[model samples]
Target: MGTVIVVGAGIGGVTAAVALQRCGWGVTVLERSVTLGEVGAGISVWPSAVAVLTELGVKGIDQAAALSGPTALRKPSGRWVVGAADLGVELPVMIHRAQLHGLITAEFGPGVTVRTGYLVKTVTQDDSGVLINDELRADLVIAADGLRSVIRSALHPQYAGPRYSGYTAYRGIADVRADDGGETWGQAQRFGVTQLIDGRAYWYATANQPAGQGGDLAAVIRRYGGWHDPIPAILAATDTALQNDIYDLTLPLVPFATGRIALLGDAAHAMTPNLGRGACTAIEDAGALARHLQSAPDPLTALTRYDAERRPIATKLVKRSRQIGQLGQLDNPLAVGVRDVLMSVGASAARGAAALRKMKQSRRDHSSAGS
Candidate 1:
């Protein structure tokens, strides 16, 4: 067994801690915050991430509500561009961010220790291990510090990090019971709605805005109130809103591993929330790190394997999410029209394909019955 220090106590770092502890490693998680918890309205935990959490011994994820009903891509006027079911894609379960965080952290066993308000101002590594602030040392370091990760900046100062996406995002949990859920794309703005496990609706919106231009729930209403039916209702039922200027790591993200420290989650690859895969990706990273450590000959080898396995996949996601955000946030009238039309065409094609598959299956069943 080896000693490891995990920076940041967010979902990714805690998941990493639990994974490492289960693998017979003594894990210490350090958080700069005064207390341990997560902030955010709602998050989607896709099946891939759920598998990773299950392997790590985290429970209660199955209790989250699976997305039901048709999720659609729509215009601001509530005209549908595409229905999600037509695409034949799998959807994620919806849960409150805090509830999901609590489930992951609860899996921390006696082998894991946590220190809050402990910030690592300086991190240096030598041939033996990595040192933090000249006080704590560990055989390995897992940096999950987040999008503006201090550890990442220290490790790769030359690399330009945290590029803004030319849009700001708003998130909130609304008390309304509206059943319809999906996204509506307008000129330079977009809104999404989905029901959480608790029956509260979670809604998120994005607007083309300058970085650092702050906004709140009222601002969200002002921007999207007139768009559609439940959009206004959801806003009216909301008490508060969270806003963040969207940002993703610059293309060619820094390597996930350098020396004894391995970057996980947003530290390794941060992307826009367009795909709802940010936290899921981080959970996957933690799982991969632990898996590699179990089989590899040494910690360094494990880190190398982790880097190789995770980087390319994360890079593709970062690129794709950004592109989707660009398309969703189109402001130009002509461009928006074109995008909507293309989406409608794609959805129709997908529905036709799905119908064909079903028809073929039905024919096979009928022939078997005759036989």
Candidate 2:
């Protein structure tokens, strides 16, 4: 077996390297930054990815994170629209992005090497192997870089870049304790919070702000500062928050693998965070890729199998995530009214109970299929 070169050391890259190394493949991770770290605030992992993590022997996530509470969907006027009590699954578990990164990076020991500050220039692949910068050769190359993947561009030069979803997001983590999860829906704006295991809260607000405009936390406070209980307090206690113009790629969700070189995570299918599947989906991608590679006969065949199995599922998830974001960002009066009505009607205790049942069934189906 030859060495596998994985570009970028983000969650997806690290997970891939770890999984491949466990399968007896030599792995090297090249990261552009000087160190391995996460800039984002928080991430939610769903049960699908959690199962994958358990299979991979990645531990401590349960202790470092907190399960999200029932989500309270409210109207712009602060009226209760829907409570996530009906939604299926454990409302995604929230963990600081840095904490998750640290956990994944700790798993790379003898067979895996991580190199930082190595900005990849180009990639060329032949029948025998792939070469990075025309110098290093490997039996396989994994482009887990990110949405702005340089390797992706080299592979698909004619493909379009990531498209902005016409919205901006503001996120902050505060050191305040809260009992229940919170969410407020306003015309063209939404705010929510999840309490971390440390008792601190990770809150986020999204609005129809201008692209590239830095989020003004003070302005957000002034606009939505008067909403409901706990929000005012959460914002008041927030020492700092990061803001960014939310964007999603318009590319068709397709298999990103080309021969022995492959793409994973955001590089493969970057979607909105509305459904909270961003990190979870990436983790699932790592798991699926690893599983295929371990069982396949050769590197090339394994990469192909990974694409065939993952492309359809990931594409559907991408579409669902975008739709959810669009629904939350609706500002029209009539549309907002309809959305609120649907939420209220759909958020009953019975509905929630039914959702949990369905979720359990779905998990079983997935497990059976994988087996």
Candidate 3:
């Protein structure tokens, strides 16, 4: 066990700190912000990420219940395309981003130290150790500095960085009643609503727009107001809206590790949020990196193993997420019609397959009981 400096104090950065500390490493987390906390509205924590947090001793998340109501995809007029249960998909537990961040940071023990408002301008490494900002030094560096990470640029200067997805996203938490929640697909635009653990509704929407086109709550309302039901109500209840021009890292992502530095989370693999797996993937990355470090003979060897284990999976996720976004954001009438029809057909087939399996299991159970 040795000293490590984790760049950025986001969810992924803090998670890496906790995992590293549990493995007997002294951890220091650096953040450029004046204060430490997340700013997002709500985030989905799938079972895989929940398990990682449990292994890291994060508590209170298990109490945050998963989605109980059926989640479905619909046309702008509320016609169902597919329900998540029809496809046997497992829904994730939705928690407020700030709450989740707090739970993870609560696990920070004496071995963990945090430095807020510290911007990492430079990082260099040798066989012995890694250096940061010309002064701070650590045996290893975990760069969890998010999509536009400076460390990532310094390491892979030749790599293409963030790529605009030709759309902008809007998100907000609404204090309104929405029992059953899911997504509504429109021509080149979409709206999704789900209940957070606290019972408040979390809603997000996307529109095909050029980058840097600014928008506000009014803009979101104008776009999605007349489309559906609870969507208008949800927006009316929201006091503020957050808008971001969606961007993901370019394909053929940079390696996760090099020498004494390892990239974690968005720094290594930033993907579109179409699959809602970006944060979950980062959590998995932290868990895997810690496991490899504990078993390997040296830090360098551990990073190599970590890269080999995580990169392929991350690559696949990035590709698959991009594909989903493309399909969901179809604008042309013919293309949208074709996409919806195909999705509906696929969902019907999935339902049939699931029923067949259930019937088979029931028959086996009855036979065993009689015997």
Candidate 4:
């Protein structure tokens, strides 16, 4: 079996380690942080991500995940722009980022060894193998190092750093009693609320701002306080919030692979959170890397195949995410009103279609009974 080293201990890096080890490869995960953890906020593991975790036998997600009922998109005044029926998500589960990260890492066990505080200054690769920090040598290196990846910088020196989404976000947990959660849109800003498995509520807000400008949760709440019922209550109940300026790898990577190394996760495609697909895509990348490696005869070819397969879709997602962010942060009053109107019209049309389909089905059932 070949040996592979993965840099970073993020959800993507840990996931890749497990996937590769399962495919008969010796795996080592190198994390810069002494301890492994994620933000206290929540992330939604969509059905696609759920499938990936199930395939890899990752536990705790099913037990710890909070299954959501109906969600909606609404105006600040509580007018529903679109309901759950319009944007049909069959099974969406929300879990704390730190919790999910812990569960995924636990699945690795002794099969994969994780070395903390081992940050690689540079990675050099020849035709046969790559050397990390000039000490460790492996048949392949997986750079899941995240948005500020040293590996990514070494490879693409000409590329600028990540592009900001022109918005700042705050994530926190609140004890508010909210079962059905949704997003409320204010001009140039948005607030999302969802239930967590621990009987708490997870809410996040985004507002138009220049890069790197952030404030306390109270300040953020001040901007969105008068929106609706649950918004003020949820913020008031929250104690602390994680504030940061959102950024994405809007500039696409040329290729996901070079020689014996492959970039995974945010290192490859750091997308905006509007789509809520960043972590989900990384999980998908890990699975795809393992699948491609199993089929290919050599690690280089496998890495290349992984690149060809994953890069296109992830790049498209990056673009899509940014577009969604732009739409959500539109400040123009005319534009905001127009967007809300269009969304309402669309939702109404979907409901009418569903009703018509139900009526037709009932008629068909009656005719069959008569027959």
Candidate 5:
């Protein structure tokens, strides 16, 4: 058996470490941060990812999070747009990001060694093994480093960097409680609120803004300040909030590997958060990678198989997520009208419920296939 070195302790890295360790590999995780921390936000785990986590033995999958139905897309004035119920695996569950990270970290035990604050400056590999920071050789090196991956640049220098999606996202956890979870779409902007397991509401807003332009929370409220029920109240009740410019990287529908080193998660295919599949896809990557390694003859062959199995699905998701973001940010009057009309036609309660059933059926089919 040989050692595996995984960079970045984000969701993908930690999950990969645990999965590989179970396969009898000695794993070392190097993280640049001093401590494992996650941005204060909520993440929706789709059924595909829920199945992955359950397989990993992650605890509290259904309880430590809010198990809700799909979000109903509504107008700024609180008028019903269309409920996502028709698209439907229990409408996905929302969990605090840090909690999920902590759950994954707990699975490794003594089989994995995690080193924080050791930023990988460079990487070099040969036929024998891979090296990190000019030293430390390992049979396999996994880069889950994230959007600005040092290993990715070292391996694929010709790759185009992440591009700003011409919008910004504002996130906050509010004290208010909302039972029926959903979102409101205003012109060029959108807002969503969902309850956490602890009963706090995790909310976010996205607006059409240029890259690098920070937002004023007060100003955003004033702009959309007059919108529907609970939104104004939710924004007003927010104790803290932060804004980030949304960006997506160009992920080709190809394998993100070169010999001994391979990329996973955001490093391989960073997508917009529109469909809430970013972390879910990463978890799926971990499962696929683990399954490949467990069955293959060697690490190199296993990585090749992993790349082949994951690239197409992850690439399609990245592209779909970006498209969803574009649709969410439609601001022009004519475009907005058209979008509203489409939503009105597509978002009836019956349609929404049917979508949810179809999503659930897809999950069932996938699970049965995997079994």
Candidate 6:
């Protein structure tokens, strides 16, 4: 079997290692941390990602994941903006991020070996093989090091780092049942809520605060305590909340691969989480790379195909995500009013489409009954 090296032990990295291992490659995953862990929050996997993970032998995610859909957009004063159906998307499967990470890690099986505490300070690709930190060489190198990836910087030094979108997010799991809780968009801020598997609630909010500020729960409570139903309760019920500044890569990489090394996951395209497609796209990259590796003549050819197939799609997604983020955080009153009006009109159109669909189904049922 050929040898492959995967950098970082995140969801994308581990998924890639397992996929390659199943393809009969001896894979080594190098992780900077001594232990495997994920942040305490929820992740929603769209239908596309759920299918890919299931095909790769991971199981029971559907049972564990609560469905996330039928959400309503509301104003901070509790007026309706639109329902989620207006956007025309399939329901995403929601599970804890750590649970998904563990499932991906478990699929490593015996074909892959994981080495911890091995930080990849440098990556260089030679004609024979790619080298990591100048100590180890493999036929291929997959960089899944995350948003501030050193490998990415090495590949394109001209690329500037992540751009802060002038927003900070607070995430936490609250031991409360909030069924009608969805997203609320106000002036320069937004709040969202969804249910977890065990009847708990997963809530998140983005604000116009400076990056890396407001790392306390009281601050969150002060800002949103009086907004709407369940928001105050969720915050008050939370034991603690974790905060992070939202940053995304604005500049698109022309090509996602160079020589023997290829980028994956956030390292490749770190888009905003506005569409909830960031992780789904990363998982897609794993499946795509694995497919090409099995079909191509060699590792280099496979990397080239992976780059060609994934780059354009990811770049387009990055642009869409940015647009959504900008629209969601609009502070101007007139702009927000226009957006709400359009959303209201779109919701009407969506409802009309749904009624048409139901009518067609009813006709089919009646015809079958008459037969």
In Å, residue 363's CA in model 5 sits off its true spot by 24
On the 0 to 100 scale, the lDDT of residue 68 in model 4 is: 73
Task: Put down candidate 3 lDDT per residue, 1-371, tens digits, no spaces.
Answer: 99999999888999999999999999999999999999988888998999999999999996764453568899888788998787687878888889899999999999999999898999999888999999999999999999999999999999999999988899999998668788999899999999876778999999999999979999999999997687888999999999999989998989999999999999999999998999999999999999999999998999999999999999999999988888888889999999999999999999999999999999999999999
Model 1 clashes, total count? 0
Model 2 residue 236 lDDT?
A: 90
lDDT of each: 0.92, 0.83, 0.91, 0.88, 0.85, 0.86
Tens-digit lDDT track for model 2 on 54-152?
Answer: 788888989988898777777646677765555544666889989988888788879998889999999998899999987878889999988888988
Superposition error at 165 for model 3 (Å): 0.7
TM-scores of the candidates are 0.97, 0.92, 0.98, 0.95, 0.92, 0.95
Model 6 residue 5 CA deviation (Å) reads: 0.9
Residue 59, candidate 2: Cα error in Å is 1.5
How many steric clashes does model 4 contain? 0
* Clash number by candidate, in order: 0, 1, 0, 0, 8, 0
In model 1, which regions exceed 4 Å deviation?
64-69, 365-371
Ordered from best to worst lDDT, the candidate numbers read 1, 3, 4, 6, 5, 2
lDDT of 6 by residue, 1-371 (tens): 58889998888898898888888999999999998767669888998998889989987797788988468899989888887766566779789989999888878788898899888898888798888888999988899999998899998898886889888888889999868857999888899999988789999888887776667788788888999888988998898888888888867654677888889999999888888888888899999999999999987888899999999999889888888889888989999899988889989998899889999999999999999
The TM-score that candidate 2 achieves is 0.92
Candidate 5 pairs with clashing backbones = 85-352, 85-356, 86-352, 86-355, 86-356, 87-355, 87-356, 88-356
| Candidate 2 local distance difference test against the native | 0.83
Which parts of model 5 have CA positions greater than 4 angstroms off?
84-90, 251-254, 348-371
Worst 10 residues of 5 by lDDT: 82-91
Instruction: State the TM-score for model 1.
Output: 0.97
Candidates 3 and 5 compared by TM-score, better number: 3
**Deviation from native of the Cα of residue 42 in model 6, angstroms:** 0.4
Regarding lDDT, does 1 or 5 come out ahead?
1
Taking the tens digit of each residue's C-alpha lDDT, what string does model 1 give over 1-371? 69999999999999999999999999999999999999998899898999999988898887855564468888889888898777687888888889999999889889999999998899999989999999999999999999989899999999999999999999998888758888999999999999987788899999998999899988998999999798898999999999999999999999999999999999999999999999999999999999999999999999999999999999999999999999998989999999989989999999899999999999999999999
| Candidate with better TM-score, 2 vs 4 | 4
Which residue pairs show backbone clashes in model 2? 86-352
